[model samples]
Structures are given as structure tokens and as C-alpha cells.
Target chain A: MIKAFIALVRRDLLLAFRHRAEWFNPLLFFGMIVTLFPLGVSPEASVLRVMAPGVIWIAVLLAGLFSLDSMFRSDFDDGALEQMVLSPYPLPLLVLAKVLAHWLVSGLPMLLMAPLLALLMTMPQDGIAMLEWTLLVGTPLLSLTGSIGVALTVGLRRGGVLLTLIVLPLYIPVLIFSTNAVSAAVAGLPMGGQLDFLLALLVLALTLAPFATAQALRISLS
Target chain B: MWNAIWVFFHKWASPRYFYRLSGAVIPWLWALTLLLLLGGLYLGLFVAPPDYQQGQSYRIIFVHVPSAWMSLFIYTFMAVLSGIYLIWNIKLADVMVRSSAMLGASFTFLALATGSLWGKPMWGAWWVWDARLTSELILLFLYLGYLALVNAIEDTRTAARAGGVLILVGVVNIPIIHYSVEWWNTLHQGATVTKLDKPSIHVSMLIPLLLMAGAFQLYYFSLVLMRARVELLEREWRSEWVREMMGRGSDG
Candidate 1:
């Protein structure tokens, strides 16, 4: 079982590496959104500083969304997913492995790019580490929760907009906590409470999302 | 007792039997709903004394509170039915979930709309980002998402099962959303009736409130049953029972 899980993760990562555009698209998209916020909202450093946490978190979310469609699409198109479902290993384990690979490709790049974006946005230096912490904790939650939406819509021809509608509501709590934690950090206030909530959400998503995603994949494939 | 409950579910599990049973139950439900709604409205709008505080505007609670309650109730109800459908493949459970989605959405909308109207006079704005209001808005979005997903899928069985998964996911998130929103900000009043302790409301206000709540529940049942019956016909058109019923008359 562990071998299958490792093999699937390694396979997905290799495929993601080969398709370099998949890795760069989300990063480029994230950068573009951060740039757009300054142009679209304001160039004032104080305003951007105040808005930075929310702006960055929202960017991560949208960028994560941009990449979520690929999680199962290629495998599903080529019939690899059907075989995974039929494999003797429990489906959720395989689904979790794929999610881990997806977060690595799509979610982790956003984390690395955050400091540059934060600098560009004039975000306070104190908050940068907290921002990274929030992303470290919260981005996987995004991938896990988002895979459920992607899996549900995998079989459909026009699931792009519908995917946003269904999944965004579920993302609200994560958005609330992570943004609060970052802002608290910027203010030099106690952020333990908010970070704790984000961690709790992460744990919840980690445990349950794989099963739900697995079930959704089965339903979509059926 | 468990045997009796199992027997009841087994009997109602059949589309034909459920259709016949719901046909018999819906009229009584409608009649009772009409009675409760009229009596509740009369007592609430006329007999209930004007509030010393907000006066006539506070009366919107008669509509707002019950609609909010029904919105949450119906969503949870649909989740339970969907859970049954997923586990046992109960056709009627799927039909009920399908029938209940729009009704739930409408109730969620009504709650938000009425809350907005009430907020205008009370809160001095049409909408406030209060915790209760935000969660209710999210609830509306969840309903819309469910509807969009179900409609997007071409196959009925696939749609039903997919919707089941979606609703179950939504149900799990609702409390988390509610708490996080509350933690972020809370301007809306706390629960007056639903708390475990005796309701904080005056007896005069409580009576009509209860009456309206009962009316909403009955109305939901009547409408969902009517919609479920139509859904059953659409789903089971290839079956003999539907053919026989079609030949009889337009009336169920």
C-alpha cells in the first residue's frame, strides 16, 4: 500500500515536472494577481501594507484554484484514474498522494514567491514570516479541499465556473483565519488564537478531504 | 422499534408506494399549513402587541425567523436524505433531496431578504456583514452550488450521487463557517428561541413565533412532497406504475 502511494506521488510529480507549464502557470498567475492589486486598487504603501495579507492569501487561493483542474484531468483523460479506482489499494490513500503532489507543484511555489510579492506590495517585514506560516499551514488545506471540487467536476465539459461557485464557499473559513493570523502578526498582536484555528482547519481538512475527494472521483467517474 | 422504523423505510423506499403515500399525505399537509400560516399571521400581525422598542418594524421577525430556521432545517434534512441515498441507493431519498434543493434555496433567500429589510430600519443599513447574515449568505451560495452541479451533470443517477457528496461536504463546513464568521465579527443578536434554556422571548411573541415555525415546516413538507412526486414521475416514467397512473387521470 505504501509502495503504491509513493509510486503514484512520484509518478504525478514526474509528470508535473515534464509539463513545466503546469508549474509555471500558477506562479505566473500568482505574480500577475499581486501586481494587478497594486495597479487596480492603489499604489499607496500604507494601503497596500494593510491589504497585503488578504491580497496575498486571496491570490494563493485563486492560483490554487487555477491549478486544481489538472489534478485529475490528465489521468482521467488517459484512463489512469479508472485503474487507480479499481486498484486493490484503498482509493483515498492514492487520492491523498495525488493531492500531496499537487500541493507541491501548485501550492508550494506560491509560498516561495510570497516574500517577493510581499516586498512588492510593501507588506510589513514582521508579517512576512507569519504570512509564510499561514501559507505553510493553509495551502495544503486549499489543495485538499479543492481536489474534492475538481474530482466532482472532472467528468464535466464546462466545470470551470461551476467549480469556483461550489468550492469558494467552503474556502471562506480558511480565508478568514489565515488573513486574521497574518494581520495580527503585522500588528505585533497575539496571533496564537488565529493560528490555532488555522491549524485545526488544516487537521480537519487533512483527515476528511481525501475520503470526500475519493468518493467524488468515483461518482464523477461512474 | 427499530424493526418498525425499518419496515416503514422499506415500504416507502419503493417509488410507486412513496408516490401513492405522499399523494395521500400532501393535501392534509397543505391544509394544515394554510391553517397554521393564517392563524400565525393573524396573531403575529394583529394580536401580538407592538414592541416597545422597535415597534412595527420588529414584526418582520414573524417572517424572517421562521424562514431562517427552515433554510437551515431543509439543508440538514436534505443532507440526511442524501446520506441515506448514498448508503442504500434509496431512490425516494434522492428524489426528496432533488425536490428539496430549490425550496431550501428559496428559504435561504427569503431569510436574507427579510433580514435586509429589517436591517434597514434597525441597523440603519440594507445589509451588514454580521456573522449570522454572512453565514446565511454562504448557505445561499452552497444551495446555488449544489443546484449548479446537479444541473451540469447529464445523467440523473450520477447527478444525484454527486449532489449527495456535495451536500455532505457543505454540511460539514457550515458550522465551521458559522463559528469563524462569529469569531471575526458579530453584530446580529444571539439566538432567542433555539438556546437550550427557556427562550428569552416574551410569551406573547413566542406563541406566534412557534405557530409560524410550524407553518413553515408543514409548508416545506407539502411542497417537497409535491415536487418529489413530480420528480418520481420524471424518473420512473419507464416503470409500469407511472404508466398506469398516467392513464387514470391528471389528479394523483
Candidate 2:
């Protein structure tokens, strides 16, 4: 079982690397959004500083979303997802492995790029570490939860938008908690509370999301 | 008792029998709903004294509160029904889900609209990022998402299955959404004093409030049953029971 899971992850990682555009697209998209916010809101440092935590988090969210809509597409198109569903290994285990790979490709890059985006946005130095840490805890959640949305809609021809409408609401807790943690860290307040909540949400998503995503994948195929 | 309950579930699990049963039951439900709504309205509007704080404006609670309850109730019902459909392949459950989605959306919209109307006089704005209000709005989005997913797919069984999983996922997130909204609201601002003082519910107000809640429940049953019958016919158009139903209607 572990071998199959590892093989799936390794295969997904290889596929993701071969398609380098998938690698660059979300990073560029994240940078563009952070740049746009300064223009759309204000160019002043103080304003950007205050807005930085929220701005960065929202951009990270949208960036993850931009990539999540395609999470299952290639495999779904080439019939890999169907084969995974039929494999002797449980579908949920396969789904968790794919989600881990998705995070490694789509979610982790956003984490690495956050400091640069935060610097570009003129976010305070104190909040940068917290911002990266929150993204670290939160982005895997994005992939896990986002995979559920992708699975449900992958069967549809134009499911991308509907996928956003459905999945965005579910992302609310992660957004609220992570943003709060960053802001709290900047303010030198006790952030353990907010971080704990984010941890709880991540745990919940890790436990429940894979099974739901697996079930949704099977249903979409059927 | 468990045997009796199982027997009841088994009977209704059959879509044809459910269609016939709902047809027979809806009119009676409508009559009961009408009676309850009228009674609740009379008690709420005329009999109950004005609220000490918000005055007569508090009357919207009769509608707003019940609609909110109905929204939650219907969503929960839809999630459970969808789970049954996914697991047991119950066609009756899918029809119930299809019938209930729009009704759930309507109830959610009513709750939001009435909430905003209540907010205007109470909060001095049409909408506040109030915790309850935010959660209700998210619930509305969840309903819209479910409806859109189901309708997007061309195949009925696939639509039901896909929508079913989405619903189950949404249900799991609902409590988390509600709690996050509460904490987020408080984290940003101090709790605002709202006019709806739930604990001090005067006996007079409580009577109508519960009655209205009951009325809304009946209305949901009545509405969903009517819609489910039509859904059954549309889905089962080639089936003999529907043809028999149509022929009986023609003969009558």
C-alpha cells in the first residue's frame, strides 16, 4: 500500500516538473496580484503594511485556486484517475498522495515566494516569518480542500468557475484563521490561539477531505 | 419500534410509492401549513405586544427567524438525503435533493433579506459583517453551488452523485464556518448589542415564534413534496407508474 502511494506521489511530481508552465504560472500569478493590490489600494508603505497580511493571504489563496482548478485535469483526461479508482489500493489513500504532490508543486512554491511578495508589498519585517509560517500551515489545506472542489467538478466541461463558487466558502476558516495569526504576530500579540485554530482546521481537512475528494472523483467518473 | 421505523423507511425508499404518497399527503400538509401560518402571523403581528427595545420592528423576527431555521433544516436534510443516495443509490433521495435545493435557496435568501431589513433599523446599516448573518450568506452560497453543480452535468445519476458529495462536504464545513465567523467578528470589533434578545423571550412572543417555525417546516414539506412529484414524473417519464398516473388523470 505504501509503495503504491509513494509511486503515485513520485509520478505526480514527475508530471508536474515536466510541465514547467504549471510551476511558473501560479508564482507569476501570485506576484501579479500582490503588485495589483498596491495599485488598486494605495502605493503608500503604511497602508500596504497594514493591509499586507490580508493582501498576501488573499493572493496566496487566489494563486492556489488558479492552480487547484487544474489539479485533476491531466490525469482525468488521460484516464489515470479512473485507473486509480479501480486500483486495489484505496481511492482515499491515492487521493491523499496526489494532494500531497499537489501541495509540493503548487502550494509549496507559494510559501517560498511569500517573503518576496511581502517585501514587494512593503509588509513589515516582523510579520514576514509569521506570514510564511501561516502559508506553510494553510496551503496544504488549500490543496486538500481544493481537491474536493476539483474532483466534484472535473467531470463537467466548464467546471472551473463553479468550482470556485463552491470551494471558496469552505476556504473561509483557513483564510480567517491564518490572516489573524499573521496580524497577531506583527502586533506581538499571543498568536498561539489563532495558530491553534489553523492547526485544528488543517487536521480536520487532512482527515476528512481525502475521503470526500476520493468519493467525488469516483462519482464524477461514474 | 426500530422494526417499525425500518418498515417505514423501506416503504418510502421506493420512488413510485413515494411519488404516490407525497401526492396524497401534500394537500393535507398545505392545509396544515396555511392554518399554522395564519395563526402564527395573527399572534405575532397583532396579539404579541411590541418589543421593549426595537418596538414594532421586532415583528420581522417572526419571518426572519423561521426562515433562518428552515434554511438550516433544509440543508441538513439535503445533506443526509444525498448521503443516502450516494451510499444506497436511492432515486427517491435524489428526487428529494433536487426538489429541496431551490426551496432551500429561497429560504436562505428570505433569511438574508429579512436580516438586512432588520439590520437597517437596528444596526443603522442594511448589512453588518455580523457573525450569524455572514454564516447565513455562506449557507446561501453553498446552496447555489450545489444547484449549479447538479444542473451543470448532463447525466442525472452523475449529477446526483456529484452534488451529493459536495453537499456532504459543505455540511461538514458548516459548523466550522459558523464558528470562524463568530471568532472573526469578535477579533476585529467588540460585540454589537443587537435587538434580538433571545433569552428574555416573553411567553407571548415565544408562542408565535415556535408556531412560525412549525409553519415553515410544514411549508417546506408541502413545497418539496409538490416539486418532488413533478421531478419524479420528469425523471421517470418512460416508467409505467408515471404513465399510469397520467392515464388516471386523463380518465378522471
lDDT of 2 by residue, A173-218 (tens): 9999998888888888888888788888899899989988888898
Q: Return the TM-score for each candidate structure.
A: 0.98, 0.95
Per-residue CA lDDT of model 1 for B8-77, tens digit only, reads: 9898789889889888999999999999999999999999999999999999999999999999999999
First chain TM-score, candidate 2: 0.98
Model 1, A32-140: lDDT tens per residue?
A: 9989988998999999999999999999889888999899999999999999999999999999999999999998889999999999988778799999999999999
The per-model DockQ list reads 0.97, 0.91
DockQ value of candidate 2:
0.91
DockQ of 1: 0.97
lDDT of 2 by residue, B210-251 (tens): 899999999999999899888888988998878887899999
Candidate 2: true interface contacts recovered: 0.95
